[model samples]
Target: MTAPGSIEPTDLSPLAWRLLRIAAGYEQRAVERELDDILQAHISMLESGSRALSNRRRQTLLELYAAELSPEQVTAIVEHF
Candidate 1:
């Protein structure tokens, strides 16, 4: 899922990438749908680069997406950005 080339300057921001990665890694439609429930226009806006998440939303995304990484794991990844 390392499509670094797919990302452009106007694409997802670092925080958005961190959140989107959680959903992209899983490829779970159900979770994606649930994500929409939690945030308004979250799916389309994120995919279209019309939005980048807040720090709090990013954490909610990882939890909602059931990512393999723990909060510590996610925090470490985020720190690198």
Candidate 2:
């Protein structure tokens, strides 16, 4: 989903779009309860660009995703997002 004022994916900040895509993929692969509820909520807010991620939240999310994804995939996400 695009942000409130964003008409397309291109309108999203690079990191926001990447996070959204990653979240979308993860959502398709597992149930919501598998993810940290706060992180999930933050991701939803991110889809609308209504809130920015805090450094602590970002690190927490990375740790959670890293636990579920391959190292290579985590590396790519770290580099890009």
What digit string (tens of lDDT, one per residue) describes model 2 on residues 25-47? Answer: 66622424655555556666654
Backbone clashes under 3 angstroms, per model: 0, 0
- For TM-score, the strongest prediction is 2
Q: Number of the top candidate by lDDT?
A: 2
As for model 2, its CA RMSD to the true structure in angstroms is 9.8
> Ten-residue segment with the worst summed lDDT in candidate 1?
1-10
**lDDT of residue 55 for candidate 2:** 51
Model 1 misplaced stretches (Cα beyond 4 Å)? 1-24, 28-30, 36-41, 47-49, 52-59, 65-67
Give TM per candidate. 0.41, 0.47
Once model 1 is optimally superposed onto the true structure by TM-score, how far is the C-alpha of residue 80 displaced, in angstroms? 1.2
User: Which pairs of residues clash in candidate 2, taking residues 3 or more apart in a chain or in different chains?
Assistant: none
lDDT (C-alpha, whole model) for all candidates: 0.49, 0.50
lDDT of 1 at 39: 46
Model 1 lDDT per residue over 20-75, tens place: 46534644454455665444456446545667656456555555543555555444
